[model samples]
Target chain A: MLELLVSGFAAIFTDPLAISMVFLGVMVGIIFGALPGLTTVAGLSMFLPVTYVMVSHVGLSMLTAIYIGGTSGGLISAILLNMPGTPASIATTFDGAPMAKKGEAGKALGIAVFASLVGTLVGVGVMIFASPVLARLTLKFGPWEYFTVTFFALTLIASLTGKSVIKGLLSALFGMMFATIGLSPVDGTPRYTFGSLQLTSGFHLLVVLVGLYAIREVLLTASSKQEPIKVLKYKMKGLGFGLHDMAGNWINLIRSSLVGLGIGILPGIGGSTSNIIAYSVAKNSSKHPEKYGTGIPDGIIASEASNNGSIGGAMIPLLTLGIPGDGATAILLGGFMLHGMQPGPLLFQQNGDVVYSIFAAMVLGIIFMAVLMWSGMRMFVQVLKVPNHILIPLIVVLCSIGAYALGNRVFDMWGLLLFGFVGLMMAKFKIPAPPFILGFILEYQLELNLRRGLEYSNGNFWDVFTRPISGTFLALTILSMVVTIINNHKASVRELKEKKEGTA
Target chain B: MNSDTKREVQIGIFFLVLATAYIIGTFGISTFTPFGNRGLDSRSIPQLIGLLVIILSIAHIAQVLLREKQVKALLENEQEADTLVCDEDEVACIQPVKGTIIERLDRVFSIKLLLSFVYLTLYIAAYQPVGFIISSTGFLIAESLLLVKKEERKRWRTFIILFSIGASVLIYFIFTRYLTLFLPSGILG
Candidate 1:
């Protein structure tokens, strides 16, 4: 691993282009992340087609760099504007807003940045060790196991994303249905092509991503017509607080990082939930629990740390099993597949160098993220002032360029517009998009394995229940759905009771 | 139904139509069973998916209808049905088109949204035929102007124009030159 790391660093630094790409990616990522409404997923997806012409390792490394930078950059707005620049920073506002209100904005920003650095380091560190081990374990997984695991992941995402599991199910089904449009798995037969050759190739992930995120975001902004938020004044002198401020918070930081990592490893939830979960955990354990929301560094640390830690946690499953935990990792997964690399157990043997280089890039990227963010804090603040009107249209054009470049044809660009509309409708209806995206991503794998498993069992589906691993996973899928439904029922019943009592 | 429930029902019905179309479309998917067809063929999964979607959509619509009924019952007990005023801003509250073209267009998407979509369509249509430089320049300027507030248009116009053309040319060169990615020059070439 150490030797691979050295070689990976050597590969990047020796090639000036690759180094610059990483730097550029990090900068763009930070800009995207620090902007309200633009997200890490949006940054990665918008930038995806640009990397298509580059070397495999270089492109992947650049994408990872973006991932790292975007995750860390959310704290800038969370601290300054009291609005989370990305969903990952939602929990940061609890303490971050208060901290800034109390004239401790600099301290809050510094602590958040430092905490992000630590969280990323810890997350990436674990990913380096855990990925290969998990990859090896996955070598034992057969068709049944793979099928059941995919099913479980789908359900987990369905249950966890947004509200309404039923809507989640519909969304996933919709995505899967869309995925089935291009071609049938296994037999290589075309399904639902409707005679257009482009339809046979179906929609590229690039088209879906750009259309859904970039185009949808533009239309939503245009439609809602929100005036851009003004950047607030904040005083900053140094790293805000010294080592003494961090002295008493070592355990909280580690615990929050772990919480982030664990949630990140789970399908469906990522930085969005992780930061909040970590914050709550930190608060519950703190001696002065009431001090959590009252401008404490501890709350900021927990929120920032866990979300960053989730970057690593999210990567583990993605690199190892090819299952993305959330939207950001899903885009990363698309990047991998775009490079013609299927990230699975055999990836270690076939593309170990590229994988290690990504790991190296991430480690380096985190350092760059922390350094550039603090040093260029004033610039990011200016970035926040870039109005949504100009920013939205500009990003749309950029994204359109990306979509057009997908096949060097106009068809994919049209696909981008189509999905953009779908994305808009999905948002309007409050349907969870993450599940649909994950479902779209996993559809091929799911269908392939299911068919293969059926073949292996000679069309007897009951055999899946006999294998311990597959059976356990299937059981867990059922259990998770049942539990979610029951819990939702209980909550609604309690709410109804409260409403009835109030009326009386 | 209230707007929210109406929205849910619309989505549910849309999915139902989608599922029906998909299931119908599956018949056109010719079967190819390689290696003696011991298990399910290519058509099986699509069919399964179609069936599953049908079930899910039914359940969704049913759930929405049930909830709407519950809400209606509660609302009726709370107050008379005559007091239920539909907000004009609510999408479901839009009556069937009955007036001028602008008023008719209001039944669908907003005029701004319609114009933006038209711009997007024109931009995409022009992307290949008219080339990257002309197409992108036009797209960026029109889109930016449309999206920016009307009051600020005069101030932003020059900067928008310069940036649009410059960005288009720069991007064309950068992609074609440094990145080695193709960008059509068309008449500009």
Candidate 2:
């Protein structure tokens, strides 16, 4: 293990191409992520084909850099513009936009950059040391166990529902039904293809992502308030933090990073939730909680730290169990497969070098982003000056091109349009698209596992309940639903009390 | 337009219609058995989803109706208080009536429907004859120009067009030549 680790570090330093690739990856990723509607997943997917053409190790390293950089680069727009560049940076805007309003945009940007660097380093450290243990533990999982784990992850939809459980469940059910549109996994029979060759292959996940997020966002923005909101031009200032500042916030940074890491390790929850949870924790524990959303550096720090830390946390499950922690990592999993590498326990034994290179590349990527964001803060902020109307249309065109470019299929373009319309309706109706997306992603695996479990038990329905792991997972799913209901009831009661007090 | 009221009514109607449609669709497809799987069929998942949707929709309609009643009562109380106020206070109280949910829904849906139609028309028109590059480039420039607000049109027209054209060209070259990904060759082929 020591030898592999040393060789990994040595190879990264000695191979000039690896270092250059990491740098280039970070640059490209930052460009994609700093642009609104372009997420880390899109960035990775767009670049996936290129990885197939390159050497496996080099490709993995470059892709890892892109993943890390893109995830961190979203903070740029979230801090500068009120619009979040990626969903992961949504929490950043809560305080970041306020800071910009208060003429402390430069200070906020500096703190975010610093925090991202520290958070990424901590996450990478955990990944390097803790991945093996996680892998060993997960290796014991059977089909029933996998099914239950997926069930638990899907229960996250309840937490995300936010005052509309019925609507949320309907949306999720719609997603699950959409997933059943392709060929059946067990019987090898065409399901909902409607006799079209295109439907037989199933909907491309990238097309779904672009349609749901980018296309939907563009369409929604078209009728939005036309009056441009004026943002103050705050001059770029110093890097702002000294060694003492770092030392003072070390505890907070570590705590937030861990929170981010834990969230990342979970299958469904990703950087978006991590940032929010970390920000809340940091604010709640602070001596001045009232200053949280009022342009405080701690808010930016907590958000950026946790969001970037999620990159490392997400990669753990992808590398070890072939289960993606989030959408971005799922795209990365596709890249891994493109490189002829299947992620799981066998991957560690067979391709340890490539894995270590990826780890090293992650660390280097954070370093690259830190240097670039620190030095190029002004350039990134200039991105905010681009009007939304112009920006949104360009994104629409790019999405069209991306869809067509994927397989040179006109049907894919049709798929993109169809999904975009679905996404628009969903947004208008206040249905959460994320759970639908998650359901679509997991649909294939869910069907495959169900079939395998059934085949093992000769169609005995009780087999799923008999397995300890599966049983535990089912219990947890039930527990999550019950908790969500109780919480909703409490919230309703609180609202009623507040109304009564207002009336009195 | 009171959006809350319109939303409640429209959503109730939408759920009822969707539930009926899903049930019919599932039943229509459930009969075809391409494979002999006695346990579960392709229709099973869709049927399950349809059932869930029906249940949830009924629940949502009930909730919406209950909430609407509460809101109506609250508004009645407020109106009673307003009627007791002096003329000057009544003038202050009588601000512009808020837009209804239907109006907001119309605003959001109209734009989305328009864009979807534009893209759909573009796709159909250019799928074969115009090819990917020419159609995509033209769409990009035209859409950018259209999306620009009227006041900024003069200031942004030149930059937006130039940037869109440049970006389209760059993407065309990158995907076609470097990445070796083939694009639709409509009429340009």
Candidate 3:
């Protein structure tokens, strides 16, 4: 393992082109991450096809770098503008904006960047060791286990859906229904093509991702009142604060990192929610919970740490089971498939060097994210000075080009507009996008495994209960759904009681 | 009666129509049965999805209606204590006045938003004919100018134009040269 790790490091450094690509990918990712409404998924999807021309290691390395940089980039806008550049950074805004307002923007940024680096390292450590063991264990999984796991992952859509369970179900169902458009898994029958030759390919996940996220954001900007952001100025003295501040929060850092890693490894949830959950955990566990969301470094650290840590956590399932934990990793799954490299136990066994190289790239990417963000702090803050009018137009044009470049078809661009409208309407009606994306990604796997499992069992659906792993996962799915519903009911009742008491 | 409830009803109705269309469309999908039909067919999952969608839409509409009724009752109770009194001959004074068409149009479609949609639509329509570079540059400059408040448009014009051209060329070269993905050339090529 050490030798492979060393060789992976050598491969990236020895090749100047690979190193440069990593740097470029990180820069582009930061730009995407720093921009509101442009997420890690959008960045990954836009760049997925571009990596098709490069070698497997180089291409995958660049994509990983982008993911790392994009995940970390959201801090810039979150701290400066109170607008989360990415959904993963939403928790950052709770304290980050307050910190900036208090003229501690530099301190907040410093803590966020440092915590992000530490969280990423911890996650990478956990991923490097845990993935191999988990993959080996999962190798024993049969069709029944696979189906059950997928079913369990689908239940996680509830966790991602914020407030409305029904809306979440609808979104997931919509995604699943859309995924069935092209061809049936078992019978190879063309379904819902509507006689168009282009429909046979169905919609590219890139098209859906970019349309729902990037394009819809553009339309939203155009539709809304344009307001220039107010930028804050701050003076820093060497990473904004002393080492003493970080030393005091070591426990918080460690705890949040672990939270991020655990959440990230679970399919269907990733950095997007990890930061919020981590921040809540930190607040609940803190000596002074009231100090949170009031320009505190602890909140910043927890938010930044877990989100960045989840990056590493997300890679584990992708590399081990070929199951993406979220939208971004789903695109990473596409990146692997595009390179003709299937990511699973077989890939790890046959291509140990490349797998290790990806691990090395992630470590290097984290370092680059830290160093670049620290040094470029001044320049990144200037990004906030750029008016939305100028920024939105540029993003829209790039998004248009990116959509068209996929399959080199005008139809994809049209699909971008269609999904853009769909996404806008979904947002207007408070329907979440994450569930829809998860549903789309898991639909093929769910149907294929279900049919295959039943076929193997000679059409006996009751056999799922006989397999321990399958039964455990199925039970867990039911348990999770029940718990979520009960919790929501309890919270609603509490809210009502409070309101009544206030009125009285 | 509230805008939020109106929006919810509209969304629910839209989904209802969409679900109906999806279910009807699934009838065209034929299962390859010559090899022996086994397991779930292609149409089954979609039909199930359609049914679920219909059920959910109806439930959401009902929820919205119930909420709207409660809100209306509360609003009526609030207004009862502050009811306005007028003479019997004051019909014009008592009646609620509606805004002019121009005022309503301005509220619904502001100049900035309307122009934004127009430029974007034109850009998309011109993309295949006039080519990517030209259409994109034009869209960028116009949208940028339109986005800014009128007083600042004059100052932003040069910067917006220069930046738009530079960005358009840079993007075109990056995608075409480095990535080897061809943007539509059209009249320009």
Candidate 4:
């Protein structure tokens, strides 16, 4: 493993184009992440197809670089604009905005950037060690195990990541239905292709992604009126602050990073939820909890670190189990498929060199992300001033280029618009998009494994429950749905009582 | 009911209709049972998913109806019921439009959103015939003019025009020349 990893670093260092591509990815990612509407997922979705013409290792490395930079870049707007650039940085604004108001904007940026660096390193470190062990554990898994795991993941995403579990499940089913449009998996039977050759191949994951995240985001920004942001001025001199600033903060940093890692390793939740969870956990553990939202470095550290940490946390599942933890990794799984590789237990044996190179690129990308945020802080702040009017059309053009590049067909571009409308409707209806995305990505595998499991069982559906691993996952799925229902009922009843008391 | 609840009910009905259509569509899928009749085929999962969605959608509608009734019952029995006034602005905004459903479609799809969609559709429609450079340049100009403030557009007009032309050409060269990707030249080639 160590030898392969070293060779991976050697491959990156040997290829100048790969190194520069990583740099470009990080720069592009930071720009996307710093802008309030464009997110890390959008960055990956738009760029994933652009990498189709590159070598697998170089392309994969570049995608991961974008992931690291985008996850860390949200602090820029959280501090300056008070609007979090991405959901991952929602908790950053709690202290970041206040700190900016108190004229410690530089101090806040400095601490956030540093914490991001540490968090990413922690996540990357664990991923380097953890993926192989997890992959090995999953090596013994069969069709039944795979089916149960995917089922469990779908239920987890549906229940955990949204306001309403039914809505989440419906969004997921909608995605699955869309996935079934093209050729049916394993059997080569066409399901719902209404005589169009383009429909025969179904919607490319890239088309669905670019449509849902990037194009929908553009339309969303266009429909809503944009308010002019008051740009805040700040300075960073010699790493902004020092080791003295980080004094007594080692435990908070470690604990938050671990919290981020834990959430990242989970199937449905990702960095967006982890940062907030880590911040709350930090607040609960802090001696002066009330000072949390009132211009403190503690809040900033917890947020930036955990979100960055989840970057690595997300990779662990993506690499080991071939199950993406979030939208970004789901696109990455698409990237891997585009490159003629699937990330699973067999990936290490087949593509050890590519996997190791991705790890190496992440380590290097984190360093580059921190350096870019500090040295290029002045430039990124200017990015907030770019009006959405020009920005929106430009993004549409760029994303259109991506959709077109999918099969060098104009059909995918139209598909982008169709899904974009669907995405917009999903948002308006309060149906969560992440579960929809994950469900779409996993639908084929779920069906494939289910059929395979049935074939293996010789028509015995009860065999799934008889196996220890599959049965446990099935039981947990039932437990989560039941719990969600009970909690939802209690919540509505409580709301009713509150309403009654308010009227009385 | 408040607009928020109304929206939830609308969402519930949307899913119910979708499930019914999906289940009907599942019947059209040609099943291949190479592993014998007992083994699940192409239509099985879709059929199962369609049924599940139908049940869930019904459950969602029932829950919403039951909750609305509970709240209504509580509100009617309250001595201070007059204090629980609805948000007038929201109620006025969501009130059914005074027209046929087809005419009311405009209420849901805003002009800006509709224009943007049309612009995108036109741009992609021209992508094969007019080429990426020409179509994209036109899209950027039209879309930017629509998005930019009317007053600001007059000042930024020249800049937007130049950027549109420059960006499309630049993107064309970069992808075709360096990335070795095939982009249609259409008549321009």
Candidate 5:
């Protein structure tokens, strides 16, 4: 292990192209992430197709760099424009926007950059050391264990249910139904084809993503009479923070980063939730909690660090267990398959150098993100000055092109339009789209594991509960759902009390 | 036509109809299956989903009804408060009456919906015969022209068209050459 680490460091230093690709990837990722409506997933997806032409190690390096950089770059717009460049940065706006208003935009950005670097390093350290052990443990998991893990992931929809649990579950069920449109996974029997040749191929994932997030946002923004709100014009002054400030918040930064890494290692829990969790933890622990949302550097640091840290944390499962942590990692998994490399317990044994190269690239990417964000803050801020009418139309065109480009099929363009309309209707009805996305991604695994587990158990239902790992995971799933319900109920009661008090 | 009430009614009706249609569709599709399987078959999942949708729709209708009752109760309490005091007509009359159902329906079918219908129709019509590049460019140009603020519309028209055309062409080349993806040429092929 020591030798592998040493050789990995040496390989990265020796390969000039690897270093350059990492730098380039970070730059592209920052640009994409700093632009609202262009998420880390889109950036990774757009760049993923390019990996087909490159060597596996170099390609993986580039993808990792983009993932790391994109997660960190979101803070730029959140601080400068009060618009979250990515959903993960939503909590950053609470303090980042205020800090910008108070003319401490530079300090806020500096803190975000430094914290991101620290978080990413911590996450990478954990991943590099812990992935092998996790992979070995995962090797013991049987079909029942796989099914239970997937079931646990699907139950995360409860956490995302904003106000209506039934509506959220319905949305997830709808997604699962959509997944059943194509041929049956186990039997190859055609289902829900509706007599169209295109239906046989199933709905494209890219179309669903673009429609559910990008196109829907575009149409909603276009329909509304309200113009985009510009918060403050940001000015860059210092790129450095004092040691006193860093030392003062060191514990908070470490704690938040650990929280981020833990959450990211869990399938289906993405950087967005990590950001919110980190922000809440920081606020709860702060002596001056009231100053958090009023614009404090600590809030900015906590959110940015946690989200960036998620990049490395998410990679752990993807590289070692063949299970993606979130949508972006799922796409990365696709890229790995495209390169004829299967990512599972066997991956390290088959391609140790490739794994080491990815680690090296991630470290380099973190440094690149800090440097590029500090220097390129002005460029990202300028992007916010563009008028919405012009900006939205451009996004629409890009989305159309991206959808069409996926399969080079005109049918996919139609698919994009169809999903866009569905997305618009969903927005009108206030149904969240993430659960749908999660369901779609998990459908194949869920079905496959269930069938395999049943077959393995000879149709005995007790097998699912009898297995220790499956039972434990099932218990945890139930616990999580109960906790979510209690939390929501408490929040609603408090809200109702406050409302009544105000009325009286 | 109170907008909120109309919206709720329309949604309720749509879900009810959808549930019915899905059930019928699943049953019809299942009947056509050649093989007789007692176990989980192609039709099972869809049928299950359809049933779940029906149950959920019924629950939604009930919730909507309960919400309407609560809202009416609140409104009645407010009205009673108003009746207890002799209010000045000038200040009291400033509050607008809730819109009628017909007015809400009209709003639902306003110019925006008409424009969206037109846009989609134009897209489908132009997609095949005009090819991907030409149709997409045209769509972008027209959409931009329609969306531009009135004062800046004329000045930006030329720039918008040129930019749209450039973008379309660039995307065409990248997708075709680099990615090995094809776009529809329609009659232009």
Candidate 6:
């Protein structure tokens, strides 16, 4: 193991091509993440094909680097423009934007970068040691277990759906319905193609994701006025603060990292939920909870740390079980498959060197993410100064290029537009998009596993309960829904009481 | 109804209609083998999803209606209070671009949005025929110019045109030449 680790480090650093690609990937990822509507998923999807010609290690390293940088890059816009560059950075805006407004943008950025690096290191450490064991353990999992785990993962819709669980479920079901459009997993029968050849292929994840995030954003930007951001005059003073600040938040950092890693290991949830969950946990557990969401570093640390930590955590399942942790990892899965590298327990046994090389690249990527983000802090802050009129058009052109380049089919462009409209309507209707995305990604797996489970059980649906793991997950799903309902009820009741008190 | 409630109602109705279409679509799907195939058929999940959608949509519509009624009751009780009082607090809290609720709603339906969507539609339509370069260049220029503030449009005119053309050429070269990804060349090929 020691030799493998040493060789892995040497492989990335000794090879000039690997080092350069890693750096380039990080830079591209940061830029994409810094730009609102261009997410880590989009970056991965766009670059997946580009990596086809390159060797497996170098290409996979590049993709992994992008994931790390993109996950961290959201803090730039979150702090400066009060707009999260990626879903992972959503919670960053809670305190980050306020801190920026308070003229502590430099400090916010510094803390975010530092925490993200720390989170990445911790997550990578766990992935290196824990993945092999987890993979070995999960090797025992049957179709029933897979079905149950997926069911539990889908229950993460509870965490994502803001204010309305019903709307969230609706969105998720809608996504699953869309996924069911193509050929069936079991019988190879056409489901909902409606006689259209394009429909037979189904909607590409890229088309839906780009359309929802990028195209919808373009439309939104066009409809809104470009509010000029008042850039604060602040000195770049050596990562903005002393170690004393971080010393007090060791527990917060560790806790958030664990939260991120745990959530990331979950099949469907990733940084999108991890950041929010970490922020919530941090706030809930804070000595001075009131100080949260009011321009505090703890909130920023929690948000950045958890989201970045999830980068490594997300890789665990992908590397081990051939199950992608989230949308970005789903693309990464495609990248691996494109390179003819199937990730599973056998992967470690067969291609241990490649796995180690990826680990080495990830460690290097984290370092680059921290260093480059720190060095480019000044320029990234200036990114907010670019008016929307200029940025929006460039983004659209890129999005169009990305959609068209996927298959060189004009139909995808139309799909992009159609889903863009769907995204817009979703926003207008206050239905969350993340659940929908997760549902779509998980649909095929869910259906396949369910059918397989049934086949194994000889058509007995109750056989799921006979298997402990599947039964546990199904129980958790029910519990999650119930808890969500109760929590929402309590929240609404509290709000009503507050309103009544105010009226009185 | 309040605008928010109206929006929710529209969404509910949309889902309800979608549910109907899904059910119909599921029925149209070719089931093929009559028996002995598998545990669950292909159409089963879609049908289940369609039914779930119908139930969920109805429940959502009810929830929205109930909220609307409660809000109306609250509004009746607070009839003396100005309607904008709540809005003012939210607006102040958000400090959104263009401030005021009415202004934001106006912006939502702005001519720029209509023009942008229409232009995008035209661009997509023209993409294969007119080529990526021509259509993209044309789009970047028109969209950029359309979005720029009216007073600044003239000042930024030459820069916009140059930037649009440069961006188009650069993107074209990067994708086609470097990445080796085949983009629509049309006549330009």
Best by TM-score: 4
Q: Chain A alone, TM-score for each of the models?
A: 0.97, 0.87, 0.93, 0.97, 0.88, 0.87
Candidate with the larger lDDT of 2 and 3? 3
lDDT values for all models:
0.84, 0.72, 0.80, 0.86, 0.72, 0.81
Q: List the residue pairs that clash in candidate 6.
A: none
Task: For candidate 1, list the clashing residue pairs, or say none.
Answer: none
Say which candidate scores most in DockQ: 1
Interface RMSD of each: 3.1, 7.8, 9.1, 3.7, 8.0, 3.8
- What lDDT score goes with residue A306 in model 6? 97
Q: Is 2 or 5 the stronger prediction by TM-score?
A: 2
lDDT of 3 by residue, A1-504 (tens): 678778988988788888887887887788778877567766766676668678889999999999999999999999988998888899999999999999988888889999999999999989988888888888898888988987787777745566766677778878888888898888788988888888888887767877777676666655565567766676666777778878768999999999999899877678888999999999999999999989899999999999989988988988887777777787787778667777776778777788888888887888889888988878777765667778778777877776677677878878877777777667656778778877787788888888788777776888999899999999998888888878876876686566455545
Once superposed on the true structure, which residue ranges of model 2 sit more than 4 Å away at CA?
A1-21, A32-64, A77-87, A90-105, A222-238, A318-323, A333-356, A387-390, B5-38, B67-113, B159-162
Share of real interface contacts recovered by each model? 0.68, 0.36, 0.51, 0.69, 0.23, 0.62
- Clash count of each predicted structure: 0, 12, 0, 0, 2, 0
What TM-score fits each model? 0.95, 0.85, 0.90, 0.95, 0.84, 0.88
The sequence of per-residue lDDT tens digits that candidate 4 reaches over residues A70-148 is 8988999999889889889999999999999999999999999999999999999999988988888889889889899
Instruction: Please give, as one word, the docking class of candidate 3.
Output: acceptable
Q: Candidate 6 — which residues are off by over 4 angstroms? A: A1-11, A35-49, A77-108, A237-240, A265-299, A317-327, A330-356, B34-38, B67-76, B80-108
| Number of the top-ranking candidate, with lDDT as the measure | 4
Worst 10 residues of 5 chain A by lDDT: A220-229
On TM-score, the stronger of 1 and 2 is 1
Candidate number with the higher TM-score (2 or 3)? 3
Cα lDDT of model 5 by residue, B1-189, tens digit:
234444545555666676677667666454333333323445665677678767876776676677566555545444322212111111111122358765543344333333543564476467767887888787777767766677888999888889888977887677668756566676567
RMSD (CA, Å), candidate 2 to true, equals 5.5
DockQ for every prediction shown: 0.53, 0.27, 0.31, 0.52, 0.22, 0.45
Per-residue lDDT tens digits of candidate 2, residues A1-504? 677777788878788988998998997688667766667766665565555556788888888888888878888788777777777788788888898888877777778888888888888899998886776777787767777776676666535544676666666667777777767676656666778888887787767766776566666556454545445565555684556545557778888888899888876577878999999999889888998887767787788889888878888877887767777777677567657788876677788888887877887888899998888777766665667666666566656766666666777778778887888766655667767776776666676676567656766768888888789889888888888878877886687667666776
List clashing residue pairs in candidate 5. Answer: B1-B100, B1-B101
Interface RMSD of 6: 3.8
